[model samples]
Target: MGSGKHRWKISIYRSTGKPETRNPNPPTEFICPISGLLMADPVIVSTGQTFERACVTACKTLGYNPILKDGSIPDLSIVIPNLALKSSIFNWARASMTDPPKAVELADALKLVRPAMAENGEIENGVLGELLIGRVEEDNRGSNLLEHAESELTRRQTGFDSCESLSGSFRKTPLALATRPSCYSSCSSSSELDAPAVGACEDGEEYVGKLRSSHVYEQEQGVVGLRKATRSSEDLRLSLCTPRLLSALRPLITSKYNNIQINSVAALVNLSLQKLNKVKIVRAGFVPLLIDVLRGRFPEAQEHACGALFSLALDDANKTAIGVLGALQPLVHIMIRSESERARHDAALALYHLSLVQSNRLKLVKLGSVQLFLGMVKSGQMPGRALLILCNLAACNEGRGAMLDAGAVEFFVGLLREGGFDSESTRESCVAAISALSYGGGLRFRGLAKAAGAVEVLRDVAEQTGRERARDKARRVLEILKAREEEEEEDVDWEKVLELGFPSRTLTRVGGQSCRNSSEF
Candidate 1:
């Protein structure tokens, strides 16, 4: 390590690429049921199952309650710090001349837990668990217990120097720590986490394999190459999106290294651009990872995450799944709070497409997106995009009611009257939304439109706008406004006929045949 500050980075090596040579006979009690890795910060859930804290957080984040090997489902509602277990694991590491296990990062832990969770929380022989164990054996080349213990001692004595030399050969670490763990001090120096030169290989599979490498530099190179390859070639994107590759790329999307996280997400965005890959990516379970990046601290990564999600949302097949995966709240949050204009733009478009799904429309309405989008439009911040989403939202009953209640008719009619919109498309979106709200809008719709002076503005749109769609929508809304206005202007009050107490059949005869006075009846 470079200094006392960099000492923690050494701890990350134990969990990343190849399996570290651990004490072959370490106590089973020291291992986390969720991660199978030695526990650094163990805690007892209400179910009395002990797990690494990061693992528990991952389960909670995924809304997965894992069934341990003993077939016990951990009640994650209450977690108590297992100080004694933590101390024991620490003591074991020191006694074995191995570094104490570092807490797994939440992002990495999520990857570990996901495979097991997918198999109904069966941790033993789970897909990822097996892949991890296999990689450990393959990477270590069956190094004997004596050699492993010697290597740990040697690594500690040489400090940063050995870390640099062994950087490419280091074994992968399993599981991660907290959301933003301090384990990796970020070996940003060229001499430390140096990436192999790009263009050494053009094979996308090779790049995917590099992603699985325990070497930080190698993983960065792999993701960067994959990003470039996918960006330029459509064929490569389709070919590169295999399940194995996606599983490997998942963890890096949340890598602590800025280079890895940014490029990994950008690569995923490129991969998601392919039409066929959309559903595969979603079914493979990457939505939550992208969401993590969207809510993560890295701005560039967040931008790419939004782009990936928007690309996925372009497919009609993925809309409901994306919405069900808990994407709405974060996408809405990004629309409002992201400083990056690109992130906000993509997030808004994604929401617009997602709202095309009926359930997502209701979810958006419940999320208070109507008011949020209206406010954004009012503030002239991404007005076009926000309005487009609002247009989609208005297509549903819940969304229509929410928009009506939010004064959408007045707001949109005002926009049209003032001719404040910058583009015809934006104006068209407003008109389309108004048209949606007007359908099945009985008296209240008539009242709102009349008050907003919608008939005059819509008449202008129908007569003046060159875009045929806007013209058609305007004409439709104008029809609604005029029809309702005519109904309101009618002089007859049907209530008086009922109050007169005429015989019902006689009244029907009077209306259907010739009108007759009550005296004739």
Candidate 2:
């Protein structure tokens, strides 16, 4: 009996040695499947199964495919940094259409793991990863999925549409599903699909479908065509049109084609400026929407929006509205940050226009926008803009001291010296700066001439002036300096006139001719 018991015990121990029955409660720590190191954390398998980190890692490293919960190969199986995961997902979504089903499946799997992915301050990465995965899935499924996704997106986007209906849906159900022509047509064709009849509310208002005009519909179609053509064309010709295009684009800005309203507004703004009807547009409440577009993400839209604001600001009636909107700060910001030189130039010109109003100039100075103008002058990226802004600033008595302190004289002198007298703009800016300094009581003409190299530059400019008017300007400056010097001197310097290379013979001949001319008179 004892021998029998010993044999039974041996058999029991043998049964326990089998792999499946080895441990009822497996050890938490195990060797990593990939690195052969002890697992530090639990591994989540694609099948919603957790394993030892060591095992999963080793399985991945050795090419042992792990299945996801949906019976697909795991998309992202490797442990990676949060930023790396986010970047990978973003790139995947961006290129998702080109990738095959396996990549799409992987993205979907990564998306599933996103919530758990944010263990320690990786929330942004997790959220972005999930979005990327969703994008990939939608892209892989093609048009049907895209339509559905867009419908959902449109529904979500409706909240900010308009103010008329705050408590109820912002858009009609048909419009939300309008991306798919069949869906829209079927819903519109069937009276049964008309939204569940909303009854009259306590406020005695009956729910009704917002009716749109045929003109708006046509404008929307035109805008879509223009966008598509612009996407394909190098010159974007379809996007550019004369004022006549406004008759076509204006209706699209109304509620009928709300999705394309912003685009329509931009096109109309461009056309309006071309037509020089900005005054009318600004008075019609176009400024607020245009300002919003200027703050939007699309570069082209932002550019046109700024351009429209600038054109509107040029009108005296619209200037107050622009200031009330607190537009100067954002306009200045765009001028400083925009990569487009034309946009920067327009922004500067707009500021100059605003500066025409005394209050606007003071407000801009209070806002410290003058520093940006100074930077532009010092950097010399846009000399025309700098010159205009300086001219505007000098228009204000309060701004004159600031302009001088900011080295306006130096910049104008440099422009005059480096930019030849033939340059009308440089000559104008120089003369303006000199006149401002001389009148502002802040500039001693003598000190300015000696310190800013004004004497030599003016002398050269005077000689280069083929125009009688320009010669007179240069001669006047020279005369002012000579008169100032004479007043400061004790003795006459008639003997030194020859030493100084004066045209003595020309002077003597002129004097003799003057005497003869007087006798003749």
Candidate 3:
């Protein structure tokens, strides 16, 4: 299916061909408790539970110590490779791989997805969606003894001819991004993160659905759709968005299948564009689940999860749940990893919205967000959201103190002068952050601000910028700079100055449309 044909992509399918050969039963001794499938390489953990080596290793890396029904985990570390189990599994696979399929198994699985094609040549999306979920569950339960669903899936993935034919019936991959040139132009660059963070499908309904259909949103997850859609209309109709749909879609968001999980998250993100859906999703217990995905290291999933959380965070009630779940560190990790610039941008935007709450603000400070923000903003990578995030964090004293300690004051001052005040919002944010740092920071803060040329930058802005808010914020920081300049005239304690905020290592190299002239102190 093309990007726009989302609604009627699936319903009935042609039996096309007989289902692949499968054995309906396998030796029980081959299964691993963790994966519920024949173990490729089993290992016994310190707790005496035998699991697929990959599963146990993943749990170990993620710190997931499983608790059985008795609520006990004997030990997590002492893992030993089970050579005996491996030999048995290899023998089982050798036998099972060539087994003939039971006629019932072939008929039943195909019947689930191949009901009847509609007159319009469309299929019911629900049909294929359900079939995919069934396949995943059956694989988890080891229900199909022959041609295990996962092995079948692997065959489809590796066999080019099979995959090509499957693609014709399924939108089996992410929609090609080339079709959405307008939506992607800015997102392809870091500039969009600096701008308003909205505009992709910022307006239409069909386009919104189409974007939500993209499974590999490694790019900004089309977040612009949610931000714009939510802002354009506030008269929400709860009936238009059903609780059942939310209930059915939530589990898909957490599915182990990345394609299914991404599409599900994007669908919810589309619904969240409505003001009411934001509260409803949070009420449906989605916030915690979404944050859990962020904590797990799924690159593509993280991009979508952060975007959904960013939209949901627009509501005040959801902010507490997100923050209380300790979402800060994971968000910071995204910024540091650069897995996808889209994930980084969305994560920053999520933090920006979450920072509206004071408690979240404190958590952000303690989590070393200031350092991350400084790194991003200083480099002008994802600068728009970075500056905006910094602006929000600058609202509180702890955030401001973190910024100073991270040596962000000088950077903000230089930013205030860059591009000759072309971006009003970024300029305003820079001024505001400077003002926050200057206030209650005593002489040291002011000295750092002045040394960064805050007085000169703010003066230039006050005279040249037309935006009253920018003019006002700049003028206030300027006043502080002038007052502090007079106070620290000759007794410039270099140590005191050095202690507050870091001096720009490249003060002479003004970045992103340089307008820098001279140092302040």
Model number with the top lDDT: 1
Model 3 CA lDDT for position 69: 32
> In candidate 3, where is summed lDDT lowest over 10 consecutive residues?
174-183
Model 3 residue runs over 4 Å out of place are 1-237, 240-245, 295-300, 416-424, 482-521
Candidate 1, superposed: residue stretches over 4 Å from native? 1-196, 200-205, 485-521
Per-model TM-score on C-alpha atoms? 0.58, 0.42, 0.46
Q: In angstroms, what RMSD does candidate 1 have relative to the true structure?
A: 26.1
lDDT of 2 by residue, 78-153 (tens): 2332333334434543343222112213343344334333432223321332233223231232343224322221
Q: Cα RMSD (Å) per model?
A: 26.1, 28.7, 27.6
Q: Give the local distance difference test score of model 3.
A: 0.54
Candidate lDDT (C-alpha), each = 0.69, 0.46, 0.54
Per-residue lDDT of model 1, residues 265-349, tens digit only: 8778767755568889999899999898888888877877887887788565688899999999999999899997667766876
Count of clashes in candidate 3: 8
- TM-score order of candidates, top first: 1, 3, 2
